[model samples]
Target: MNSPGTVHDWVFDAIGTRWTVTTPSPLSRPVLDEVRAEIDRIDLAWSRFRDDSTVAEMARAAGRYPIEESDQPLVDWYRRLYSLTRGAVSPLVGQTLADAGYDADYSLRPAPQVSGVPAWDEVIAGHDGTLELREAALLDVGAAGKGFAADRVAEIVARVTDDFVVDAGGDMVVSPRTRPLRVALEHPMDPTKAIGVVTLDGGAICASASNRRVWADWHHIVDPRTASPVREVLATWVIAPSAMEADGLATALFFTPAAFLRGDFDHHAQGFHHVTIRRNGSVEHTAIPGLELFL
Candidate 1:
């Protein structure tokens, strides 16, 4: 039984970041390890840096892969983001990130590079659940994959207990679907300070920053159109119904202006709450009615 007072924690390193899982009840070490293994398996499917990952294999052959129902959610989210951001947030920027010296090893090395993203619109999806990429492009799921993993972490915890927090780096998913969690937004310009904190009433919260993974003028996040770094925002945070959406929207906010993300540009999807840090350390946040962000 879980109460408000109990917090069981597990920490581990994977996919270049530390992941923390806080459960209200004892989610035993074996169970947590199995969750970790599941994450490891998912990484082999989504990692851009791994030479043997499914994404890499697809890039190698520029061919089709069996897309099961499990991958449907990510595909749907990626497609929606790709359209909303007008291709700024893409699923085919693997080569661009690699050429900028952020390849699998993540050594933060610098190389003179000309980067480009493939035409994801030209990608083929079959009725039998297969996705084919016929270009010289790689897939970099980045924190979107992490976000998906975090969601899975929450799902595993929810099966046993209702109270849990799965923080995969900055992409987090909190269980019970209604408990509010206070999260501090990391300041991008200054490493030691927080820009703000918001109460995540439910669902997931994800934060992304280009400066976190940069070498020289190149960072992990690039503008799909120009094949260069996005200059508008230093960092972004987004909260949505799922960690995957929050993570993808956080990346989109980096390239998307704060104006459009506000005022109901689209109504079919869940509403998104956002906070953006600009280049000069100035911050702006948008709230949807009941949501409040404290600076």
Candidate 2:
């Protein structure tokens, strides 16, 4: 259901992705300004592109000492991602990326060098908010940044209205609305066609597609176990109670084996739902028992 007043739409760029916020009610100009300011604050703190960002500063300060406790979210996210990927996704992949010709920055005059795959265990986080690395390690948060941004913006929007959605790239956080929110999953190989639509109610939805970051047949979603691109799953969607979970799970599912994509996955994740699109274009969905499917 729509709100009683006019629907307002706002768009801005943050965390290297486009962010959109939609509300069903006519918000006062001052309120809208405050919301935008909050979004900017989040980007400044969390953006990996900014050299002064908390993540970048922490990465630079690695091996020197642990950062402050206020930087706990970055540490917490690293721990969660490590557990979720079984150490398959780590900030330690900085060396792998450097060897793949992405050193320093992904711009003109980039450095090219061969470096060994850094191990996750070498990168340690202390309870006092300090991060240490046994060896030189490069941390990349490309996989989780959008989700983090979505989650942050969602919290801000929730303060103003009950019905709102924050879409950062393909990850989204949707609050309770008058009706179910419909989300369309794009085909991995063909952006024009949607493979399916999922009806979301007061949860977050995130989709990861394999074709977006391909380079010479190699993609960004690397399998840390093999230090290679994940080839089996073309796309994965995860629905969870929060955008950060959904975002991390979607990336982790790309590295999950096809056998695990079957019914048994639900046993591991209690309330989460999954949709996997195979390389052959076939779709498989598994959710908790009795869950409805819009596709």
Model 1, residue 123: C-alpha shift (Å): 4.5
lDDT of each: 0.75, 0.68
Return the lDDT, model 1, position 241.
76
TM-score to true structure, per model: 0.88, 0.81
- Where does the lowest 10-residue lDDT sum fall in candidate 1? 262-271
For residues 110-170, what per-residue lDDT tens digits would candidate 1 score against the true structure?
A: 5676667766766544314677665545877773777888887777777777777888987
Global Cα lDDT for candidate 2: 0.68
Residue pairs of candidate 1 with colliding backbone atoms: none
Worst lDDT run of 10 residues, candidate 2, spans 107-116
**On a 0 to 100 scale, what is the lDDT of residue 81 in model 2?**
69
**Which residue runs of candidate 2 sit more than 4 Å off their true CA positions?**
1-5, 26-48, 54-61, 64-74, 102-104, 107-114, 125-128, 257-270, 288-295
Candidate 2 structure, TM-score to reference: 0.81
